[model samples]
Target: MLSNILLITAVGLGSFRSVQSQSTPSICDNSTLLIDSRQVLTTAQECTAVAGDIVIQYASDYPATIEFPNLESIDGSFLSINFDEDIRVTRLSAPKLKSVTADVYISRWVNLTTINMPVLTTINRVRLNNLPSLTSANFLSTLESIENNYEVTNTSLKEITNDKLPFAVFVEIFDNKELEKFELKGLKNASYNVALRRNKPGVEVSLPALKEVFYFEFQRISSLEIPELERVIGHFVVNDSTVESLEAPKLQNVGLWYDPSISITNNRGLVIQNSGDSESLSFPVLEAVQLDLVIRNNSALRDISFPMLRRVTGNIGLEGTFESVRLPELDRVGGIFSLGNDEAGFNCGDLQAFKTNGTIRGEFSCPRYQELPTRSSSIGESEKEIKDWLNWASPSTGFESFRSMGAVAFAIGISTILLVL
Candidate 1:
């Protein structure tokens, strides 16, 4: 009887050991895990804690749903890439994921429609690219900071809400076709550059609270209005865009790097007027430009008025068909002053004074010579000669004189020569 009881006890102990051996294994056995398409994640215990990187490569045969409800932080990078032309992964949810110590890259997932990372707030860097079908990306609602760069390119991301990321070095958004508006209403500062280029037409960019930046480049945008931008430590360039109007009400200084600091060129539809309306382009508080201030090739531009512009440390080049050019408050220029196209004529006395006082560094051009004394004439005599010349060169017949002045300016390298009438 004792032998039979011992045998039964041993058998029961063996059964319990067998059950323990068949139970679910811990998924965190290794530091790194590479989940391929052939594997299946059936339970949450499959990924409890990853000490190292977690790379997920999607294939067509993989499960459509991927969720890690218990994952709170990744000690290493989190990378997801789908090479298959027909991606089967539709949803990825990591509800409790809060931080990633390294970079997070999600690229080439053509068919991925949704991504949910509700509590993710911090990461080292982020790159979201080449996801065409991804129209909505609200996964970064709580993202407050990034250590390095933040780049979003070639995606369908439309808008970014007011998220103040003060730790980022640079933010670049380009080649997004369907993006219509971008609101950085909460961003008050950045450490480096902010470049927005090649987006859809008529896109409105509002940076209401941006106070300073190292560099600011806005290319191929429709309209740019930065009401609170005060200073740029580097260059400020707006080129090849369809922006009809531009206003930076509080911009006080530009070109901390030096020459070619402020360039507004090739915007065919840009206009400058002083009508006290929103459509008119003006920089009321612009105090100085450290380098070149170029305004060229804007065909629709009619008038230019810089009321409070005080100084330019570099050259100033203006080449366009403008009806009127007014710089009533311009006090000094450190470099050359060159203007082409004889549409608006200027008084030679003003040009001579600016040149004589060492305010203009290089060649100055005056396309239309309105009135001037002869080589052997005095100042009083020149005044009478100018009046008589004005009678002949009336507004109706000014076109011929403009043509003549252009030819003469081209020949002599000076737009107008103070020749006797």
Candidate 2:
């Protein structure tokens, strides 16, 4: 009995000492914990899990390196932002962090250099913006799944290639001046837009497994490869880009959404091809474009050919300097079919049959087939030209037909000499 009491007393004393060591308040024990100074950060070093948000921002004299060695999870968001531009932290590391239930938004940190979240795997959303000094982030390589969206802008990272991520609702990766290559090898579809704009000039993009998207827009890109893309529901725009050859070998239907011109609605019209700088633009097996097929301003393409295209429900506008156009199987166009070129020998005689045969349901105008203007003069210019040409013409029977009333008219008389015999 004596030995049992002594052992119990020793165990109780050890537990009491352990509780006394943690005298400071836990940062995770509240709904929101703000870490503004080194002392505040030190007080949270013992916490293993944060039930609420962890906001770290608006501090100038921060430690050189901030780390959470024991933090495992955060039910809320992880935000680090400052409007006054005073955050001077160099590295933000959570080596053991694996999940964040909410977004991980880190923005406007002018002096941050590295984001060393090595084992982070899942999150809701991530927006890393205006981190000019951030060179690399280890979490991007290990992330396999995400929820809402992923957006990154104004960073110095060179490449973002992920073969693990399969799907995302919205993605915007732009204004990263040093990004060189972006490849999403496993992404099968994007239910919404996947836009990459204003990135590096010569960035190479490869979405080999993408089959469909709502709207796919690429700008300032040099090389793009989408070998398996089949459908674009909204718009497929490649503007201000320098891609040499664009071959959508499997793309069949473009603008398969609700046609805006069908009803008196507020939706915008669908456009398939807006602008590109490709030398060869070919959609070999495409059969239909539900709405407008605006293939214009493709300056370097020598030909606009869709050999198997059958119908265009909306307008078809093709403006380029092409040597020839080959749309052999086109049967109908619901709206205007406007085709113009700057080539000398470009002809449109064969296309006139579509209009006469009623294959085109709306207005049609091809090269050399448009009707000339019947009334080609203004009223004022016509009167001036007519009066100048007919020098002997008298003014109209009006009082002030002439503009200058002070001028007088001169008459020449013909004299006849009579001889008396």
Candidate 3:
């Protein structure tokens, strides 16, 4: 076999020249402190506990504040990314780095401003991207814990407070063009996701000690507080906000487990009939919504209440211009039950007795409502038309799940070509 492939290509070129001659690792050796030249940034300012990782690249004459005065703890990540040029460190003083078991990536640092890690607490992830002259990041007020994500993008950092982080799974802050304000005031719980988009448009958010969450998305807000949230194991979206009003005084539930979707879009003066924006499409004490609940194009929402809603395992779309539509303890609605109100003595006779009594098992519109179907963004048979869309939310393009595994893999490739004839 060609001399055993030339002795395994000479033992893989001698193991790539012994890993390119151990890419310069010395100070507090546990490897990786590749601070590219300037004598490895003065031997990484004499590391003070750095098991591994500490990449600060692109250096041709580095300096201008890079102090690490006796760095402390960093069993991993602490990168200072630089895609090619632009990385003339403005400031990165690790004032006694507290902890960073994993990531603390600062990407595309376009002339970093200041990141004096004034006692970083506990971290597993903290991605700060495209920093446009990062406006000081005093360690986000001593974080307490973060097992996963805590992202902040396109920063100029106007405000970002954390009354000693309590708990979170994933926190995203988007395109921060001088981020207005944010408050995580001792987050109580955030089991999964918490997203915010395209910032700097009258932003002012507050968590006020969140109670529970699995997924929460808020966009373009003016002021949206979560005064002690209750629960949400899945979705709870509030879109294109101008945040006129939308209270959740201890909400109850909104989709848990499989089949879940809730989108309250284009909030333009969310619900207003009385003085207080008619409870501002309130949820004084919501009940359940384990599947699809789309509230569209908010035009000063006329009036709509879920007064202790009962259940909805799917679809329950409600369009704008409403006068009054309350689901007095709705029992059930597993699929389609739309309402496209135009106001003016709006009444659908108790939702047509919930589809003439049966608790609406499927398709049932009210007061001439339409356009209520959109999920499954791909995957066969037009994704089963979207109604009770759930095959884990689209993915098994029918055909009886590929007809017995494509007929036993085409009968084992025709019995392996008749046993080679």
Candidate 4:
């Protein structure tokens, strides 16, 4: 009986000690726990301050400022907060803030390695003017806006396309000289004004729903097709490429005026040779052409035909070795006609048939026949004396019987003098 009672008393004391040790909070614990300046804790749990949370202030002790020096990653699935009314959450900077939730807005965030912020997909605002050392950013799969008329400028980004962001008032991706390929496939139904200028070399851009392109350079590309391109409020240049054919039927508007005359120059391999025998091939209707209809240096070119060309208000010069030019309804050319440096196979019979309003100045010859010699205007003394004498006597030469009348008058005068003697 005595041993049983001693055993019960010892077991009860051991249970009390176990509860006391487990209930003690550690120094890192901030969940509903209060600590004095000199007090220490024994738990590793982080703090969660509610709206009416309180903290003990000390005279010589300092509050925490976010200084993440040796942090590898912030992987805690916990909620963090500030204790005071001003809500200074400055003590929580991490080197690798990966897979974090909630829309976090921080100013002067200097020590972050990379903002792989897939969680912060919809950013209402971001201010990085004070963060000079920030290097890279991993955007969300559906990142929308960084404020209105905003972009990520002055950085080293290779390819940027927010698959979730397509609609805005204005968007600019300018001065990104190192960026190569940009595909806005998510912008199929957007009604925004987008401009992309001065990209890197060998870049192929595709914007199917593009309405207004300020300027796009397909200089080093092989093929380009925008079947739904409707308008271009500025210039559209396609230079230095091997684009063989260009057929855009739904391309309605181009420049400030609809289908304004465009210049496609310096492309050696670009052949816009329409082959169909239709009445009119459809091209973008242009108001006025500022430069010449520059068709030069295309050696493989055979024919130049525009069946629907109602009016050519500018100069149309076809200078290469083209076989023929067939423009059926062409009228009202604003300048002269020129065809130069074509050796053989010159069949301008269709152009020569139409009585041109402008002057024609070429020798049309064939392989078997020599070119008809150009008639020269003679200005020699014999020709000049003949012209001057004819001009003086031409009016008198028109009178009826003037030659016979003068001969008869001289004979009558001599007959009368003989009769009187």
Q: Encode model 4's per-residue lDDT on 228-313: one tens digit a residue.
A: 76544433344444444444445433323222122223211112222221112223333222122334444544444443333322
Off by over 4 Å in 1: 1-31, 38-49, 58-60, 257-279, 329-332, 342-352, 368-421
State in Å the error of residue 223, model 3. 18
In candidate 4, which residue pairs clash? 25-42, 26-41, 26-42, 26-43, 27-41, 30-47, 66-90, 66-91, 259-286
lDDT of each: 0.60, 0.67, 0.67, 0.36
TM-score of 1: 0.71
Where model 3 places Cα greater than 4 Å from the true spot, the runs are 1-25, 28-41, 45-75, 79-101, 105-124, 129-150, 157-171, 174-191, 202-216, 221-233, 239-297, 300-311, 314-320, 323-331, 334-342, 360-421
lDDT tens digits, residues 200-266, model 1? Answer: 7556777777888766777666777688887776556777666776777777777442222223222
TM-score of each: 0.71, 0.78, 0.36, 0.41
Q: Judged by TM-score relative to the true structure, which candidate is superior, 3 or 4?
A: 4
Task: Give me the candidate number with maximum TM-score.
Answer: 2
Angstrom error of the Cα, residue 395, model 3: value is 28
What TM-score, to 2 decimals, does candidate 4 have?
0.41
Q: Tens digit of lDDT per residue, candidate 2, span 1-421?
A: 9999999999999989878656435668677778887788887766678888999856656677889888888888889886355655778899999999899999888788899988888998889999988888878767778887878899988987777777877778889989888888888788787889888887889989999877678887777788888777766667777887777877776655342223211111233233456777657667666445666667776666666676665556666665666666666565566767666656666555667676666677866323211221354543442233223221111011111222221110000111000
Model 4 poorest 10 in a row by lDDT: 412-421
List runs of model 4 lying over 4 Å from the truth: 1-158, 162-178, 186-198, 213-218, 257-329, 332-343, 348-355, 358-421
The better candidate by lDDT, 1 or 4, is 1
| Model 3 accuracy (lDDT, Cα) | 0.67
Task: Please give the lDDT score at residue 306 for candidate 4.
Answer: 45
